[model samples]
Target: MNDVSMPYETHGRTGQKSRTRTALVTAAREMVANGQTPTVDRAASAASVSRATAYRYFPNHASLLAAAHPETGTQSLLGDDPPDDPAARLDIVIRAFTTLIVETETQQRTMLRLSLEAQDAAPDHAPLPLRQGRAIGWITEALEPLRGQLTDEGLHRLVLAIRSATGIEALVWLTDMAGLSRDEAVDLMRGSARALLASALPV
Candidate 1:
């Protein structure tokens, strides 16, 4: 019995559909990595899939771009054996997060451009996945040890500050504007995360 409510990929010929979806997403990511914002049709062409099939997976440009975003579905930045100390945990998470940002800078930049364009096109448009604050969840999880010591608001503020210092936006300014090397930018971001956490701790 086919469940009509299921997603297209899960409905029929699941293996082949899943492969088609992965190919589309892979093509889109490759395009994004090369500094191109890809449409579903373009991604389909790149992936050697038909336009009709691509549209079945991604209904629009926004949906395709969102699916291509490097950080779209990430749920956590910490490792399986993350330390209990909030500072150590934060350091681990921030380092991993910044590394991902640097390695995927091209994709990040494309998404950032799209996000800005979307904002300019519609003042009230919902933010793209790039600006949707997934890092906040990761940072908050890394700093969860401080939840008891600090109020929820305080912890949230700390998370926001760290996120502000350690993401792609900060990376772009540090590298392009401040003329820092990628390594320097990452180090500074990690230091800023630690400093923010230290400030929130008792002296």
Candidate 2:
């Protein structure tokens, strides 16, 4: 059997496509980091790529920004050898999630602002990245051990409640409206997540 039958040309072509996609996304991310809500054309200009090429890659500002979103793919907040206790597991998840928010605070705020504008411009607009279920999936995974104890409805409700207390929305309110420092906000989220777990599971 020929293990290399896939051919170098195919590999090279795939690699090129990956690089092009990365370039477009990187341009959008850098523009977002600078506090500019960029159109697909602007990202193309920043990437030194043609607008047509960029459009082929991202299609619209929403899709472009979605790919560029800082929290777009944060799948696992858990560590190697994660604790089996749901409360402890959730604490670890909250701590890691809050750390991400602090590090990408600027980018998160930009995405949030754009999400608001999109919501206003069209009530049925495409979902912004942060509003997608990435965090929910991760949190659910962390709390998987509780499945036996919780009905599906109960588990879902608990996830939503914890999500409401954590994540970027909570950070914005805690820091901007409540005037807590970044560290203070993180601590508060961790505490809230642990408390929620305890109440829900009652071990």
Candidate 3:
């Protein structure tokens, strides 16, 4: 019978490629966290993979960046069944957003840098706005009962405020720039969100 193990060489190559792709992503994230630009060669070396292997998965800078930053899609901390009460739902979303920011610090920073770089290279490539929309959609749905209380402009302002308060920009400022510990920063964000909601929403 023909030997199935004969293709060991091909299997080894596939395994190496998978390892290289993982390494490249890890290295790229680290570079962004350290405030350094992540180039293909640097990422390859950091991942312990050859430059050629890195190119095989990510043909160009844009492709590599896009691969590194993926949206969480429909998986949100606030489950599909939103709370029946508007205020309770808002609380859930605010807490979820705050937790997400604190927990995904490294990934958040990498995404922020990737977004800015992509915007500079090609304004149309920016994905931050789309991501922001997803967050706002959650907030709006939760606050549907208070729809009449908030004007369109007011709602927009609220979304912008929340986004600004919970993203990488805030994380970096609180942690690196302002010298707050991760826990402290997260607590501060949670408080800020609560304060905003209390002030913005009607009684």
Best by lDDT: 1
Model 3 clash pairs are none
lDDT for model 2: 0.80
* Best model number under TM-score: 1
In model 1, the Cα lDDT at residue 56 comes to 86
CA-only RMSD, every prediction: 3.4, 5.2, 8.1
lDDT of each: 0.84, 0.80, 0.67
What is candidate 3's lDDT per residue for 1-203, written digit by digit as tens?
Answer: 11111232246576665555667777876776676667788888888888886777666675555445433343354677777776677778777776776666777776677667667877776454324455667676666766678898887787678667865688799999999998888788767866787799777
Candidate 2: Cα lDDT at 58? 71
lDDT of 3 at 137: 73
lDDT of 1 by residue, 45-80 (tens): 999999988888887887777777888767788878
lDDT of 3 at 75: 38
What TM-score would every model get versus the actual structure?
Answer: 0.92, 0.89, 0.62
In each prediction, how many residue pairs overlap at the backbone (N, C-alpha, C within less than 3 A)? 0, 0, 0
**Could you tell me the lDDT of residue 109 within candidate 3?**
74
Query: Tens-digit lDDT track for model 2 on 1-203?
Result: 11111232245576675666777778888988989887889888888889876776677677777788887655577988999988778778877888888898888888889889888888885565446777788789889999989999999999988999987899999999999998898889988888787888746
Model 1: per-residue Cα lDDT at residue 159: 94
lDDT of 3 at 57: 68
As a TM-score, model 1 comes out at 0.92
Off by over 4 Å in 2: 1-12
